[model samples]
Target: MQDHIVVLTGAGISAESGLSTFRDNGGLWEQHSVYDVATPEAFARNQELVLRFYNDRRRQLASAQPNRAHQLLAELEQRYRVTVVTQNVDDLHERGGASNVIHLHGELTKARSSKYPELVYDIGYRDINPGDTCDRGAQLRPHIVWFGEEVPMLDKAAEVVRTADHLLIVGTSLQVYPAAGLVYEVDRDVPITVIDPGEPASVSRARFIRKGAVEGVAEWVAHYL
Candidate 1:
């Protein structure tokens, strides 16, 4: 068995395949505010609007493909104990062949009961419309962990980071909390490699690859691995 390897991914990785970011240079989504669509209050106020936003996301995910970075990460699984802790809701990491993945934000291909967190269902190609109810007569909601929702996987992700021998950070601003704090959980001695176009704020000293996800990651991995 190889030493532990932990990877953290975010929207930038998926953006390589043409997916949109939540905020891009003061984009519409930023102005619209995630609070209006990504909060429990928003959903409670207008379920239809919330459902449509996710439906649009789901459809976009259907058309997007994994990029070179995703492929390279998956290839690492062959020789290393790779654990992907992603903030992204997409399945590209898995689609590109990564074996062990923990999605902190929840998955788009799944839905959970509004009344019960454990009652989750996989709805690969189906649309989640209003009034869709679970067996217990509870409404079904998107599996996403909204802004105010507790990130259940955060503790598990921290444990993964603590055991890692090496850390790979890809395509995130390191601004989002909890998920971003995971970098601090890594053993101080462990080496870190951050691949991104911009300078990232890392917990420890990190070797920066100043390029976008696809181009930078493929070239860097080829040189290092």
Candidate 2:
């Protein structure tokens, strides 16, 4: 079997593609507070506001193209079994030509029934309005893991990390919970490389490349054994 390379990505990867991150400042998401747009309570309180916010984000994501870092990581599939565990909601990785992606937070191209989390559908770049409904007539919401919700894919992500022969973490500061905890699941001997601006919390044994995603990842992967 080909050696596995588990890649953990965060907003910092997409930042190179011109996408903005929500955590750069305290809880403010696109000028709105996290409580105003990223939580179930917010969605429950103002569905229209939440829908509009995501609609704007979906539109921006539609215009955003995959950057060099995204493309390079996808290209790694030629020599190794590459699996991407992304905290980002965008589809840049898939658009960059990578197969085998696991969205740890959720995906922006999908909509799930408010009543049944299992009922999810591909929404592409379309806007979900107030009248949108699922098969059971339940309202449709973004298929995202919000602030107060549980991460359904965390276990699978942990499993993937545990099986990896190599690990690459890009763009994330390793501050996000549950996802951050995943690094601890890696076998101590597995080598890790972190590429980001801020200081990422230390993993088992990491090689830090403090630069933007494209430059840093390109530099490292160039001579990767």
Candidate 3:
């Protein structure tokens, strides 16, 4: 059997594809505080603003091409069992040819029913208007794991991490809760590598490559693949 290689990615990886990171503008996105546009309360108070924010993000994602870092990880599948667990909402990893991916923060290209989380649809960069309704006649919301909302995929991600023969964390600072805690799930004996320009405090035992995603991943591929 091919050795399982679990990869944990964040906004840093997608940033190379021209997508902006969440904390780029001093904890603001598009001049709005995260709480103003990325929380369940924000959606409840002003659905129009919240929808508009995600609509813009969807358009940005549509224009972004997967960068070399994303492609390198996909190429690793030829020799290893690769599974990507990404905090990014964009589809760059999939576009880069990764067949197996778990979106921890939800997907920008999809929408879910306000009433039923299971009722999701692929909207694919289409603007979600205020009145856009789901199949059950409820308003459709961005399928994002907004602040104050439980992450539905957290358990599955931990399980995936536990099975990793090797773990690679790219482009994340490991500051976010739940997701940051995943690195602890790997067995102590498993090899861990962290590739990012900034140091992630959580993974002290990991071999750190202090470089941007594209450069860092390239260095990793040269040594491993």
Q: Give the TM-score of candidate 1.
A: 0.95
- Error of model 1, residue 86, in angstroms: 0.3
Candidate 3 per-residue lDDT, tens place, 92-169, comes to 999999999999999999999999999999999899998999988999999999988899999999999999999999
lDDT of each: 0.87, 0.92, 0.92
- lDDT for each residue of candidate 1 in 45-81, tens digit (9 for 90 to 100): 9899888888888888889898888999999888789
Off by over 4 Å in 2: 25-30
Estimate the TM-score of every prediction: 0.95, 0.97, 0.97
In the predicted model 3, the residue pairs found to clash are: none
